[model samples]
Target: MRESYSLLPITELKGVGARLAEELEQLGIATVDDLFAYFPYRYDNYELRDLTDVQDQEQVTILGKVQSEPLLNYYGKKKSRLTVRVLSGRYLITVILFNRPYLKRSLKLEDTVTVTGKWDRNRATLTSSDFHIGQPDQNAQWAPVYPVKSGVSVKKLRVLISQAFTQFPNRIKENLPKELLTSYKLIGREQAIRTIHFPDGQANLHQARRRLVYEEFLIYQLKMQAYKRMKRSSSDGIRIPLDQKRIREFVGLLPFSMTHAQNRVIDEILKDMASSSPMNRLLQGDVGSGKTIVAAIALYAAVSAGYQGALMAPTEILAEQHAENLHNLFQPFSISVGLLTGSVRGKKRRELLENLSNGKVHILIGTHALIQPEVVFQNLGLVVTDEQHRFGVGQRGALRLKGKEPDVLYMTATPIPRTLALSVFGDMDVSTIDELPGGRKQIKTYWVQENIIDRVIQFMKKELDQGRQAYVICPLIEESEQLDVQNALDVHAQLSQALPGYTVALMHGKLTPEEKDEVMNSFKKRDDQVLVSTTVVEVGVNVPNASLMIIYDADRFGLSQLHQLRGRVGRGNAQSYCILLSDAKSETSREKMRMMTETTDGFKLSAYDLKLRGPGDFFGKKQSGLPSFKLADIVHDYRTLATARDDAARLVQSPQFWQEDRYEQLRKPLIESGLTQTLHLD
Candidate 1:
């Protein structure tokens, strides 16, 4: 019976036509099942209370008698205020409602009324959020409020959902096993959905919400666990023996010593490579922590085993940088490295493709161009992707498809919070380089206002005079009328005029790839004293001599991004400083500035960022393949998530768990929702 509802579209509901269907689709509701799943974002309680029991500014509902006639007053264009004096107990409260002039006609002197709104005690005013001509029914006190768009009113949604419940009676079957549901003390699926939309009271609301949240988390965790198992048994992975002698020689060839953290991570990667199952791991390290060298060693291990390697980066600049570094590192061993980007075209591109296909190129590094149709490898064994969040799951999966079950390594500079890792990248094993290399001093950070801009410029001039380059970063490329913040162009112009002889170069997203490279090269060679840019220099553009980073309107950027920008400096041995320029008056902005100066730990900053922005805005966009949960919050509902994960792990390992009748309802989502088809879940 529940399966039948999945096939019924929203148009089947009364009063829902083509236009209304399109509006409902905007809220992710296409079918009757979807409408049932669209839970309310919040609930408004209108339980009646006495005037004496109400606190100042509390949203309260009180039954009263109108003491005077409702006075209607017209104000500014199309605006009106309706005021009525209501007597409740010993107090006479003024019930004020805005833009509700029609209410004045129905309200008469000495009439019984019920009003729900904010109570201002000092002024004896009840600013009406909602009102009833008489006492409202007890069951209608708790009103569910959904997130809606224009032309789709909350009243209309309530009507549609109520009709769905009446038309499809007892059709929502339970998806969880009987034993599991009883153990967890969860309500039935149908009751949970019904109570969540038209909740009876606080207790039932909590119970219903808990059931829905647990179910969402459980399904997501099951998907992840199934995907992980599929990767492990999908095919036989390349069992490459660890070449200790070659790795040791490469390490010895380097001018600097590897940190314990880097060495430990390398050991983990090598272990995964030597296993029969393919390696699906995420490598996390702060900027300039020698992650590249660790990746280099892994690439070396694959190439020495007579299989090709590929490193995919989000941008061409990072890819080219890896190409140059890998070419230099592998030159002593006589292993060839090839670079393929969008600019590498015509005959050169053809030659590179031929070399990669025939095994002449031992290591191939490029951007998205590496995933094209013509690009093929002789024996691709390992894949490493830089800044894994920039690319969606499809992009990453596309690169993996290029090889025959290649061991994949995803590297990121932004440290994902542990809770987020469990939800987003839960399928992959995680390896973190917690320690920075020796001899690198911690970057000194400070937050300041725009009034002291001249002093900050003077400090930058001193750094420039010491033969150290600096970066002046802004949040925007050009001036924005909406936001009165500093931009790259204006900052570049101001810095040029402020400092007489220093060359202030500009870089932003508007520039061509070649132009960006040229400007970055000039700064790298100390030809430009100041490089003013946007967040484009946030990753992979490393200059060892740059000692100062001044971020304008720093409050506008998130904590993780600010940390990435700070990482641009402090690459060299000399003492580095990051001066954040902002005069934001909000407490949240001030807190962001304070935290930026408190610690340089990327993991700590990322956790705080996740807390401040939630998961939706944490990645600056909706991350691909990250579950869009309706009721479960990874940050707040972490304990519930952990429980769901544990339950799912146990269920997946159970023999014939998918085929059992007790688990039959669970298979509907896994199969009908395309989880089985996409991940090939058994």
Candidate 2:
């Protein structure tokens, strides 16, 4: 029964008909079990409050008698406002309702009703968007609000949930073992699921939340542990020997001296590459922190050992940049660098593949096209990826399989907090290049109102007058292309009108690749003194002379994206500044702006972002190509994650644990969740 629980359709439940089921389906509730998984995003405290204790702007539930008949006032063609003057002892407060004329039938003179809303001090009225036709204490202690669609009403959803719980009492089975539940001080899984939708009391709701959070985190930790074990026990990796003298010569000839952090990370990678076991290392660094330099060292090591190395980038532009950078770095040592991407085709691609397979080409850099079946390496020793999060775990695995025991290294400019690192990249060793090279000036940042456009333009002109380039990032707002194109054109027109003497150009994703390249190159060469572009510039368009960045509609972008955009500047020696222009007045937007201006540390901001927006918003919902966890939240469930990680490690060590009957209920869910794919143990 528990194994096939999710297969039971919502239509089978009482009070849920075909039409109602269709409405519920809009919220992704097709099965009876999906309703259980759809936990409340927040709870409304409908607990009754005394009239005397109510403060201005406080949401409270007041039980009062209507002093006079409810008057319905009509204004515009489709608009109506209902005013009910309610009396509670000696105090009188008006209940204002918008577009709800039907309430006049239920609420009459002397009718007692419960009102829950915010008290408006200026109007001295209780504006209620939600109310109940009952005594206050008779209602549920806590009102759970599920994520709703446009047509679905909260009252109807609550009724359906109550019916499902009542009719399917014994159908829900307890999943966790009794010993495990007792040890963790958790309630039964069946009770937790029931309480989550409609809690008997506050204590049960907290207990239920704790149980579900632990379950989600434990399964994730187990998957990570199994992946780690498989890599250690796998026999396909080829060990590459590191020569100290060869490395010293390569480092000595470089134009700029390597920072201590870069050198330390290189040393760590060298040690990992030298080991017989396959290397899974994540290289994290802030923008312009020399991550590419560390990756270059590993590629050289692979080539020096008579092996081929592959570097994959998220976009063709980045791939081209890496190809150019690596070619310049390796040409001094006579190592051939080849660029392979989806665009490289026909005879040219065929020749590159042949050269790559025959050991003639020492290094290959490209986009996802490098993972194609036809592209084989003679002695592939290292696999490196820039913008590693862009590729899913499956894509990374596919690349890792290309060579025997090849070392896998990933580099990212977006700093990931350590807590997230342990959950997402738990299978890999972590390396961080946290320091900038000596004498690099800190980029000053500011968050300003949209009205300060003239001042920002004046600042950009001052920078351009000194022959420095500036980037005005036009947000590629998640809207229609016509709107985005119009925004770019509008901003371009404004900047051009403002700074009439300077050259201004526009770029966006809608532009052809050739057009984008042309515009980027023009900006890079200072032909276009100021370039206005969308977030496409966030990846790898490095122009050191560009010291000014103006982000329009800054509130629309996430903290991580804003950080990456800020990184575009501050690459050169001159002091740089980022101007974040936004008119959004929400608290969340204000907090994001405040954090951006307060600090320049990417890691600190990353941790703050994780807490502010949870894992999904910090990265995307499809982060690292990882699927969404149905129940766990990385920010709120950190302690549970830590415990789960330790428990998973210990559980895998117990060879007899999997053979026991106590964990029988966990098998189907774990397999269906895809956690078992990472676990190689039969």
Candidate 3:
């Protein structure tokens, strides 16, 4: 019954003919409720101003009579500009337009017109892209400006939104219980939508945004709590008891002492694995943190209990590195490690698969190929996914299904804020390794402008002359169909031409698995070489001697990716440096550069990145398994998010919300509006 309005197609509304219906379809608005959910991206304040009071270079709106007919001037075949001279009593102002010749017909001599644009004193003209034929609207506070496609106009959307509201004024239903809204001081869903689309003033808009943010966050928190409950009460898991003797030998082989942070996280993982319920834990450590050693400890304990362990990485290169490192870690303890990826072929692949199925291989490390259907496990009791954000929920689940609900440990180098951790990964037990291994030095980072490019190159040359390796990271961007981004290929060519004696290697997503492995291996061996690549090198390329890290157009990278790229360099004991080259003149871009230079703390950087860029950019599309909320900015409304999470945890704890028939209606609506089914939380 609650889905009736949302079920109706947008074509049923008035003024939505076939042509308009096709236009709306392009925006993913096929239903009546979809049109309503299309909120404004910004607002336009229509403040009326007197012509005499207009200041220089100010965006103002003035009403006056047209003194002369509009004149159109042309530069070339398709180039033109418009001018309309206006007079308000004794004051006079010339209005200029850039490309809108269509507005020429709307002007009539001596007709009162309202012009809204920037006022320039030097030219004594107002540069306007917007003007109308009506008198100035003194009472009009603001207007909703929505995002539109090619065929749709802002005026057309305004008309359609009004029609939708008129047709379904009272039909727009609220999903939250009335008491919940009253207790939390949140407005009803219908009122929130109305005020958001057609806000009366700033205060009303603020209230409208508050209500929507709460709703978006609440839905996400509910899913988190639901998954948490499932993990706790269910017993379909293998209990891997702690092995003190085996663990002692495993850590004894390490070259350095373990940090207190690492020890604490290992204990948490051990507790979860020893339980009856399945263990879904997230282990996050800063770059070079001893997360790998902790994971090895868990694998060792799992193997001691006669259970096979599988570790999945996002990239083939990373998978290979893990196999090598893990093999070394378990060599003295006589634990066998197998490597499986798409690159393995013919007899080698068959041998690994047979060994894995027959329980000969104690631990398996590979890329997404580990989740394939034919990859059977003998006694897979534990599945550890490194950099878990790189895989989707389905990929993680497929690996777990190899053995009935194997205990899952998700590891990541990307650090997020604690509030965000509580909101997004609430379903999983979280453990953090904040301390780096002893003897590692903090990376010296600098944000360089383009004018000093030559000087920066010389510094890198000095590093190379000193027998140290360096990494030059290119920006990853795709602006439009007609424009190609400056990717690794272009940068590699330029760098090869600029640096004569040094060997420069190229690697990116377009390279084949064998090609990437070959290039990475070559880069690792050559001390005088520089690897010019993209973010593909962010995770797996770990050469300790590689001390210099330079990212071109560094402003294009988010704080997290930039931090991960920096992590690639400082993995060794030698003093390291990260240089960011950005010529961007924007304040936001410069601010990010400043933040990078000030600190190397991933947690603090992530929290700042959340505030600088919204949650969408923080988790991108394919990575970070989290589906972004449409309206919730994790930075601004953090307090609201905390409240929502607490309320959801409380509500889902008791059986009354799920068992009572009255509250069942509320649960279904909220779940359906979000990506509950996509993440397999259900």
Return the clash pairs for model 1, or none. Answer: none
For candidate 3, lDDT tens digit of each residue in 91-189? 787999888888788888899988888989788798885788878655455778888995988888888888888997776777777778899788878
Worst 10 residues of 1 by lDDT: 673-682
Residue pairs in candidate 3 whose N, alpha carbon or C atoms collide under 3 angstroms: none
Worst 10 residues of 3 by lDDT: 673-682
* Model 1 Cα lDDT, one tens digit per residue, 482-552: 99999999989888999998899999999888898899889888889899999998885779899999999
TM-score order of candidates, top first: 1, 3, 2
What RMSD does each model have against the real structure? 3.5, 5.0, 5.0
Model 3 TM: 0.82
Best by lDDT: 1
Question: lDDT score of model 3?
Answer: 0.83
Kindly list the per-residue Cα lDDT of model 2 for residues 1-682, writing each as its tens digit: 1233348999999878888888889999999888777788778887778867888899888888988788999998989999989986667989998899998888767888888889876676998967767677544768888878867788678888888778887767666677779899998887888777777577878899999888888777766776676567656567787777898898888889999999999999999888887889899998778999889988998888877899999988789889998998888799999999777889999999999999999999999888889989998899998989888777888887889778999888878765567787777778999898888888899999988788888888899989899988876633465543226677887788888778998888887767777888888888899988888889967899999999988888888789999999988888999999987679999998998999888887887777877776666666564436766777677778888888878776565445566765655555565444334464
Better of 1 and 3 by lDDT: 1
Q: Candidate 2 has which clashing residue pairs, if any?
A: 236-405, 237-405, 238-405
